[model samples]
Each structure stands twice: as structure tokens, then as C-alpha cells.
Target: MADPTLSRRHLFQASAGLAAALLPARAQAKARLGDDGLYTEDWYVDSFLDLPEDFAAARGKGRGFALQWSQRGCIYCKELHTAYFADPAIETPIREAFDIVHLDLFGAREVTFLDGARLTEKALGQRERIRATPTFQFFAEVDGKPKEVARMPGLLPRPEFSALFRYVAEGAYAREPFDAWLGKQGKG
Candidate 1:
């Protein structure tokens, strides 16, 4: 109807203007890590978050649950948290199973464990070869030692991720390799 080129140009200009307006907001959301190398508030969303202190007594005494690593600037991690961890569909199982700790892969803060050893988040990330954002590593309590049993890198669609979390939480990894266990469940 009206001039098509003119309409297309106007659309492009509007889209560019919107992108410009969003730039500052995105930057603000990705504020620099503090001197400690962690977000000022690593707490999960809302008032339901648990304190790491609650897991203090279990340190080194037994094989306890630990989530691998995270960084604030990672969009996939944000979506993973928002879409999976925060969703009621999966949050209940995670809360019941693991003592979740949000670690900044590049942060310099001291991470105090239940056993009382302190290390930086960067050190831990390096130990895990964390080359990607939003990696989920599972640990098994074998003879009271925490052994890395399985890991998932990147944001997985819910059903598979949920199944993996459940498998670990239920101690099914104790019986077999995660892939084999997943295969048994028809999800491998």
C-alpha cells in the first residue's frame, strides 16, 4: 500500500532506537563484581533462600550436595535460574536435595566450606575446567568424600535437566554411570 521502502526504513530506525534504550539497562544489570569477586547478594530470588551456614555441620563429615558454578554476566545462567531453578516445577526438588551455592567463575572472594578451608571462586572454577557458563556438576558422597559424578554444561531443556537433578538427588548415580541410569529411565 504505502511506500514499502519507507515503511521498512522506519521499522529499522525504531528497532535501533529501542536497542539503544535497552543498552544501559543491560549494563546496569551486569554491574561489576565486588572486591570479594562475588555478587553483593548471591542469594537466590525471594525470601525462601537458605543460608550456607545451614550446611556448615555437614562439611567433610559426609558426602554433601554442592552445585558447581555460576557467573552473573551469563545470560544462559540467568535463564537457567529463572526458567528452571526458580520455577516451582523444579525448585522444590532442588531445595530439598542440594545446598546450592552461587559462585562467580571470575570472582575473587573467599569461599569457606563446611570443612573450614577457604578458596576463591575462580580457583574452584578452574579445578572444574569450567569453560562454559551455566554448568551443573553433580557430586557423590563416596566413603565420605565428594566425588564428581556427572556434569551438564549449558542450559538444558527442562525435562532432561529435571530428570538428571532427580537422579542425583535420589542417589541413583550411586548405582551406575549417569548415562546408563538415564538410559534406564528412557532419557539417555
Candidate 2:
């Protein structure tokens, strides 16, 4: 006759091993940092930090401009890049619809705002009153000025995030609030 205690211990050990095996992929999926100590991605648009030019280029391609603000040591930013943005469902639509530009929240790199104001990334963040990492500012050209159509101040779940890209891509921001549009889609 087998000891019940021993059998239970074995079962527990197996379950623990299985859980441990599943943890690595997610735990190890930390975003890769560049030499500048910023997370790097090939998909991010390499720009001269000229917002007007970037907006025009994106419009020329029939897309909108997406500015993604991140900072070093921001876990939310890391999670967004590693988990949410990495999702195929989210990446596909964003790649197709927006010219995504990455901005370091505290970076010293010079940027020319759409209104022709020159400032460093840090100054721009200050001017924009960005209080969170991973803030997304979406823009559309209106009357020759790049107007902010929508702004997301923090990380959104995959469904909402994907919907955001579609919302901007479809020019729905001009007609309705994101929450209203999301509600119509039964996501609210």
C-alpha cells in the first residue's frame, strides 16, 4: 500500500515544476535596452524629432502620427513594449495605421514641435504635462496644423489598445470620444 502523504507530496512537486516551467517565458520577456539605456525596436520610426515633418510624412502615407513617450526604468513601459505591443493582434493594426515615434521622457534630444517650437524631449514632456510613462499622443493634420486628436496617458489592455489604433486610423476621433466609440463596439 502506498503512503497517501507521499503521493500528495509527489503531486504537489509536479504541479510546482509545471508552474515554474511556465514562468520563464513571461519573466524573461523583459524589453531589451539599447546603449542609450532606452528600449529599442526596429518598428519605431527613426525621425529627426521634427513633429511637423513627421506628421506630414505620415499623412502622405495616409496614416496618423503616434508619439509614444517612455522613460528609463519604467516598468509599465517595459510591460507595454514586451507584452502588449508584442501581441500580434495589436502590432498588425498599429503598424499598418500609424507612424509610431518613440520619445524618451527625460531625453536631451532636440525636438521641433508641430507649432515650430524647439525643445528637448524632456522639455516637451514638461510642456505636455505628461505625468505617466507610456503616454500616447495621437495627432491628425487639421487646417495645416497638427492637432491632437486623442491622448492616452497610460497603458491600456490589448483590446482597448488595438481599438485605439483603429479609432485613430479611421478618423473616429473627429466624431466621437474614444469611450463612446468603444462602448459602441461593446467593449465599454
Candidate 3:
């Protein structure tokens, strides 16, 4: 008296469940190694290297715009993609609130600046005075155009990193210094 169709449905469901169970419990990739030899996050913005357009798109999403400057063979860059971002408490808010564009500190790919200057990534790095890998350039709209507002020269440990991102999100730089704000938040 058992319905064959019902039995088949249960078998299929069980098969699917078993397949899932057979897979690795921690199958998620922490980071991807790009062709450029840099490690990157899955959530980083993909773009045409147009700074103005990228900024506009990020603004449209109601998110902050940031440029992540890194280089090939940079150990700190690897840690940024792996360890720092692995912390949900650190990554969640920042990932949700910012549109991060990754750039190579020493790359040949062309990038168009907000000022309409088209240059290679290496040139842009020089123009921006970038002397270190894993620098973060935070931009804000000023006079109806994207302008760099904050620059973090290198990586910070978890709490400070979290606080820095929060500081940018809160627009706290206009009101006070980062150290002062960090102290106020009890994270300095």
C-alpha cells in the first residue's frame, strides 16, 4: 500500500543529505590567489579601474569607498586576506558597509583616476606616495567628486583595524583624530 513516488522522494532527499554530509565541513576558501600573485577576498569590488565610476557605484550602494593597496609577495597582504578577515566580528560590519577596490602597488594594469588621469597602477602608487603594501586609502565626496580623506599606511591588529573601519563609517575623522576616537571607544 506504500506509494512508490513518496518512497522515491524520500530516497532522493536522503541521497542529497548524505552527499552533503560526505563533503568537508569547512569547505569554504579563506582567500584566493589571483593571477597577479596577490591574495584577495571574495567580497572585494570588481571594476574597470575607473576611480570616479567606482566611487559613484559605491555611493549608489550607500557604502564607503576604499582602495586597498597591496603588492605581490607581501606577507601582510596575505594575512589581511586570511587572518584579519577571518574574524566575523571584524569582517562582517566592514564587508557590509564598504566597497573595497583592490589595487596593486606595483602593477602594470591601467587605472583611471578621479581627475581623469589614466595611468598604470604603479604610477598611481607613486603619485599617491604609496611607500608600503597593504595601505588603505579611504575616499569621501568633496565638491561633488571623490577625494581621499584618510590613508592607513599599514595593517593593524584586529581591534585597531575594526576601530579604523568604524571610524571611517562614523565620519569621525572630521570631528576628531583616530587615536582620540579609538581611546573614546576603549579600543586604543
Candidate-wise lDDT, in order: 0.62, 0.84, 0.87
| Shift of residue 41 alpha carbon in model 3, Å | 0.9
Q: Estimate each model's TM-score.
A: 0.62, 0.80, 0.84
Clashing pairs in 2: none
Ranking by lDDT: 3, 2, 1
- Clashing residue pairs in all predictions, respectively, total 2, 0, 0
- What are the per-residue Cα lDDT tens digits for candidate 2 across 1-188? 86656677798999999999986654344456777767755667899999888888998999879899999888888888778756656665777778988899999999998889999999999999998989999998777678999988998877887888889889998899999998899645
**lDDT of each residue in 33-130, candidate 3, tens digit only:** 89989988888998899989999999998899999999999999989888888767677799899999999998999999888999999999999999
Angstrom error at residue 28, model 1: 24
TM-score (C-alpha) between model 3 and the true structure:
0.84
Q: Summarize candidate 1's per-residue lDDT along 34-113 as a digit string, tens digits.
A: 45433322333221113235344334343345554667667776676545654556756665556555667876766654
**In candidate 1, what residue range of length 10 has the lowest lDDT sum?**
40-49
Off by over 4 Å in 1: 1-64, 112-117, 186-188
lDDT of 1 at 132: 85
